[model samples]
Target: MALSARELWRILEPVHGMIYFVPEAQERFAALGLDRMAGYFASRAAALGPVSGEVVVATFYNFNPVIVHAAVPAAWSVTTPAALVEARYEAVGAALRRGLGELADDVSELAGLVRGAAERACEVPQGRPLFAAHAALAWPEDPLLVLWHGQTLLREFRGDGHVAALLLEGLSGIEALVVHAASGEVSAEALRRSRGWSEAEWADAVEGLRSRGVLDAEGGLSEAGLAVRARVEGLTDSAAEVAYAGLGEGERERFVELARPLSRAVVASGMLPFAKR
Candidate 1:
């Protein structure tokens, strides 16, 4: 099948999420002395540099600024950027090594393909802030580590663009969550708790979306809602296209072919919570 940007995104999502959302990965970070929120700060800050709480909030998109600020100390106080970079590389490498093991052999097996994709992705001049920062970072020498980093950069590239699309569409955070939920990207309750919105606040946002004809009474997206969602996705894909534009004729397909097995190994290892779609 010819992959649309959305389909390509699905292939990449779990691979990227494994580093941050996997139970074992979280536990490993905890072992390294980072709590849930702190782990988020440490990883993101390391990649984004010693940025302020507000910048993190803007780049992260969905979470409340206050909530993001609470996690900022994990990055600023505990480790310098250089140290955190090394630490993040170590942590992610450990998780993937444990998860992929013999199935992936060594970093050598995947390094060139990852490097090609990343180098191509970096060629895109215009990018949202988070993706831009990550793309500017030096690639790691360990092939496995570089593979993870490359995927992270690509994921953030899409994410930053998606956030811009949502904003351009005039969707508030809760409303954005409502649309995402209605489309089944994430559960509404999970998004609410993750974003630190109160239950009443979430309900009000749902009602607001319904009032706007973006959602129906049962909290599903109506036709208008679906159209709006599709526009957001289309805009996101458009913004994200520059990164992939550098790929040579067949390279996108080749990159996907090379990446799929490694990604699947990570998923099958039960390291990430992403349900196969």
Candidate 2:
């Protein structure tokens, strides 16, 4: 069977996502005088070279600007972007080393495979600001970190596409979260709280989506809403297909084969208990 872009992302996402939930990241960021929220904003945005919170808000696309503003630019005052980047790398390496154990030794081939796709994606950086920023960074020598970085690049590339898809569907950031929450994968409360949106703001978004027929009376996706969601996801997948242009079908399958176990290990390590799709 041919691997779809969504399947490929499902296989590799865990490896890239574990960094957000790992304790090592928090510890390392704390050492640099950053708390959890500040650390998250700083570490992820560091690749962009000490940009303002507005830039982060524009690129990140979901978080409340107040939350972003509270962390960024201020984060630059406490530590340099170079240092934050190093800290995140150190944290990812430590967490993966501890989590993957012996599997960490055999990541060279997987790293190469993922890097090929990531570099290919880098070639078309026209609108992928976050991915472009990470792509400009120096590649790490360690295979495990290489795998992590490569997956991070692809994740951001796909994320940028997702944002574009949402915009094409005429959904605002909060409305996007509302649609996602209605999908039953994640709760509206969790999305609202995590993004720093108040209940009233969330309720207003829900009402807006409801008025647009994207949500039914029960707050779940109606038929039109489901179609809209499907279109957005399909468009996102289409956009991400460019990353795998250089990989033959067999190589793509092999990439998934090689990555599945590592991603499973990352999931089983209990380091990503809070991670959601």
Count of backbone clashes for each model?
0, 0
Error of 2 at 269 (Å): 0.9
Clashing pairs in 1: none
Residue-wise lDDT of candidate 2 within 68-93, one digit each (tens)?
A: 99998999999999999999999999
- Considering every candidate listed, which one attains the maximal TM-score? 2
- Tens-digit lDDT track of model 1 for 146-188: 7778777777778888888999898976778878988987888
Off by over 4 Å in 1: 23-28, 31-33, 73-75, 106-110, 125-127, 274-277
RMSD of each: 2.5, 1.4
* Sequence-dependent TM-score of model 1: 0.88
**Cα-based RMSD of candidate 2:** 1.4
What candidate 2 gets wrong by more than 4 Å, as runs, is: 275-277
